[model samples]
Target: MTVATFDTAVIGGGLVGCWTALFLARRGARVAILEKGSVGAQSSGTNFGNLRLQGRFPGQYPLSLRSQAIWEQLQDFVGSACEYERTGHLYCAFDEGEAEKLEGYAKVSESYGLSIERLGREDLKHRYPWLADKVTAATFSARDATANPRLVTPAVARAARDAGASVFENIRVSEVRKSGSGFELRADPDLRIHCANVVNAAGAWAVEIAEQFGETAPLFAAGPPQFVTEPFPYFMSPSVQTIDGSVIVRQTRRGNLILAGYPRTAADPASQRVPVPPQKTLAAMKRLAELAPVLRSCSVIRVWSGTEGYLPDMVPVIGASETTPGLWHAFGFCGHGFQIGPGVGLCLSEMILDGGTETPLEPFGIGRFRSGVAVSEKFRREFDERKTA
Candidate 1:
């Protein structure tokens, strides 16, 4: 066979990789995507589809904002239906302390241009009569919404293909090495792909790809358990979250109630399979019952799990590699990449094509992990200080 050379090679065909390839190909660069499976077959298609802005880490606020804006105009770019729904989002609190924290967060969020409204106990009960009586307060971000996870990545891949990008499905990259002028990717059997630059958006298997270039990050597999109930009356509209990060509940357009909030199971990134624990499902169902008593009559019809990468700092690693030139990394999204997938792609495309991005990529560099201070330790210390504050 002949050599396949491209200006850029993307190592994943998920939503992020597809968007990155779309932007690069649109910019007149030769781009090809290598996917171990069909596009959005794994985490991208299996997530709860929350395009939320509330309760996110402060560092992710800007990216979430940008991604939300892109999501609002998704069809304009992808030229396909993503099943996007602007159902708003609500974070409920069960106690006064939790409510106070939410009130404080709402105030802080306003400075960032996020108009989150805090509802007191009476106000929340009056607006959402279905909520559990234990709910003391809630905060609502009207711009937050949900979409069809199953449709997003495929739509993006189709858009990228229309923009002159090639997507190779079920072709796994066994190994990658720096060649004389670029990188050579060794694939199944006799396939070899040469590219000037590679973007490691390999989803759950991102760490392995980054390691080939001498870049190391602390990423672990976290599989959030999810289940869907039989179609019922569409009572709930907005996606709902708890202030303590326990249970997330949402009702789809088809009236199927989808939820996730239990102990995560170990995930195998290589296989991209995560089995939901039976006990965890029961526990999550119990919690859901407490949050919304009306769910007691709803029977869960199906349960599933998706493999997601979780970094120690709970942040993503984006931008150029520190050790290897002509290499870039954009992975380790820590279970929240779904909301910011498009923004990450746009920023990375800008960095690769324009030498810099409007979005700040310094905070997500791999150098942060190289520092003597471990992210887990820093996070623990910060949490302790916050408790005192």
Candidate 2:
């Protein structure tokens, strides 16, 4: 059968994949996205929609800054309502030790040009009295924001399609191998595609595609439990987090409180499915009540979970393939890729079409795990065991 060809074929139609295709097509490169399921039906759609710049790893701060700027201008290009809001992020510390840590992080983050304002108890009470009295110290970053997670990826996919990228949904790639100076992909019985370059943006399943190309890392599926409360009078302003890393709390414009915490559920690798255990939600609610007494009276309306790729160090693989030429990877953002999704796609597009990116991608290289040629079995086994357990 004659194979349809393009300049690039992006596997996995998550936010990264769709944005990559959109940027590539805008640059006049023929691009196609092959998705196994519906666009944004997985992690990207289910995340808490936090566009935060606070509490980011040092290496990720630069990329997140660029992403935040893009998110502000993104609606003009995507042509859809993202429900974007610059709600800011307030991280509260319940005690002296947590306050010290928050202060340290603020000092370091400020070195990177991030504006972090440390707030003492009196400052917090004066600015945000809605918070519980236990919050003795806090840090605020006003530029951090939120958006509608359900609307982002699909809007990007539609914009990519409108920009001349072929998007084939529900086409699971059965096999992918190097072809003559390019790569070939077989989706099913009769569908085949050949492209000069391939991108593995398959979210949690990216490990399998990376393995097929002789590259691997300690990536495992991790699920974060999320819940929303019934709509009430919106009292909370800025999105809140604990310096102790206990929980994240935010209130939507319509007055629903959203929460996520450390109580994790397992995600199945084979099916890429994460089950939301009711017990974890209960535990999260209990912790929330402890943090903010007002939440004790709130009624939960829904609970859910999203499967994200978690590397051992919690960073993602976001560079060219170490083994295969013309192949690239842009997955494994841990559970936080939603915020930097657009910036990552632009970086990958620049790397592919322009030979390099202005954004420093050195820290995200696949070779960090080992040599630039193959997977390290030792790292793989450790992460696999931890994931399964």
For each candidate in turn, the TM-score is 0.94, 0.94
Q: Estimate, for each residue in 1-389, the C-alpha lDDT of model 1 and write its tens digit.
A: 54688999999988889989999999999999999888998788888899988877777788878888999999899986588989899999998898888887887677689988878878977888888999988999999989989999999999899999989999898998999878999876567899989999998798898887777887777677889999989999899988765689899888999998744666777667888877777887888889999888788899987888777677788889998877988888867889999999998899889889877667788778877334553234323233211
Deviation of model 1 at 125, angstroms: 1.4
Each model's number of backbone clashes?
0, 0
- For model 1, the stretches where C-alpha displacement exceeds 4 angstroms are 372-389
Q: Which pairs clash inside model 2? A: none
Stretch of 10 with least lDDT, candidate 1: 380-389
- For model 2, what is the C-alpha lDDT against the true structure? 0.85
Off by over 4 Å in 2: 371-389
